[model samples]
Target: MNFKGKSLSLKEYNDLADILQNKYGMQFLGDYEALCSNIAAGKEEEKNQAKPEPVIKQGQGDEEKAVFIRGTIRSGQLIRSEGNIVVLGDVNPGAYLEAAGSITVMGKMRGTGHAGTQGDYSTYIAAFRLEPMQLRIGDIVTRPPDGKQYKSKVPEMAFVKKGMIIVEPYLGKR
Candidate 1:
């Protein structure tokens, strides 16, 4: 499954195809079994896929960076960015990441990450896992608990709660 540097699969790209094809239908295509019947199935196939675009134009003033990185950050790699950052692949141990805003991992991160590096408490960091060697936000830092319960779990998010960082479950957008 090393699809790194590759385009998204048709299946992965089409998960929300039906939703995109409908704007104001009485019944959404994915709402219920019966509701799906009324929606035009062909619409999904007819809709054109929108490719990604850069957040900032090349000639834009001030040159704001909303996101940085598009590949695996292996062990020992270090990334210091002023805006949000994304790792399209795994982040191996010994890697260091610092972002002023949120950080998203379309893959796994097993290194050290510090979102809110600019003291932005609103920062959020998410990966295919929350099992990093260390996680931090602003001036607060916490290492993954060295126990069985954490080592076996899946991907999650880390956010501040009660003036402390608390790792919690993340179900994508929800």
Candidate 2:
């Protein structure tokens, strides 16, 4: 009865509904679109209402805390972590992320990523495709140049350099 942990398209949902009704004699209360919308709304509500729990793991000689996210961050969502943060998906526009440690995105970043939120300038933000609306490290911030477009789809890293946030293409092993 629960569809959690599964990603299904409209057609797939409809097919499942049909199978359930025909084979199991189970009746669905709402239409396909309505059901999907309700599920999405519920998820958004849960995210908005839920509080982030601290994650702790044993490191080489101490305990390290990090937050890991596996899905795209939509607009209006804010992800704040007391330690490092790693996102496996893209960060959409209007979304925000603040972390006391480094922030890493396995996909594109088009939102605001504020690393070193606790004033640790050594922290950095790295993404597979960096085209963020804003990048912040400690007290420094950087934005895309006016009327400038980055054509390369290479990975990039941003860090505080000389009191300013500098973003450069990530070569290997930095």
Candidate 3:
């Protein structure tokens, strides 16, 4: 190809490709010889195929079992459930929790939390100390206000209302 208006030799082209691959984890598709070889060997099709979406199994009936977590969910941890999720401990930053139903954390929630993942907007998220980095309920997404968050003495809950996610103080209701 051309570089700085000069025709680049094969070696220079490959060297540039290697640099790009190493620095950015990107494939350089300009190597015709390699492409032809890969295509002939049927490896190109495998590499180009799109990844399949994940399938979530449904419960036997309309009621699904809730998942209960009993310890601190530290950073980098991910939790997912088909039904509701109840965490008896804290969820630290960089962690994630996703559920098709509601999410209830008895302790602090300072990570990413998603509830109603299956398009059920009626689900909600409740936490004793709700200061999550991000929150999602159904298709709506929200984040903490861009300033210091006030710590509430009472637990807080989030739900979708009027196509927007709203946070409100949760009063225990049997």
What lDDT tens digits, residue by residue, belong to model 1 across residues 1-174? Answer: 111132334464354445455653434333333333433443453464354343322221112565567888988788876677788888888998887776777777788999887676667778876668898987899987776645525678888887898877787554
Better of 1 and 2 by lDDT: 2
- Give one digit per residue, the lDDT tens place, for model 2 in 114-134: 988777888889999988888
Q: How many residue pairs clash in each candidate at the backbone level?
A: 0, 0, 0
| Per-residue alpha-carbon lDDT of candidate 3 for residues 9-101, written as tens digits (9 for 90 to 100) | 668767888898998888666664754464556555556766634454443111345789999999999998877899999999999998988
Clashing pairs in 2: none
Which candidate model has the greater lDDT, 1 or 3? Answer: 3
Q: What is the lDDT of residue 118 in candidate 3?
A: 86
Could you tell me how far off, in angstroms, the CA of residue 38 lies in candidate 2 after the best superposition? 48
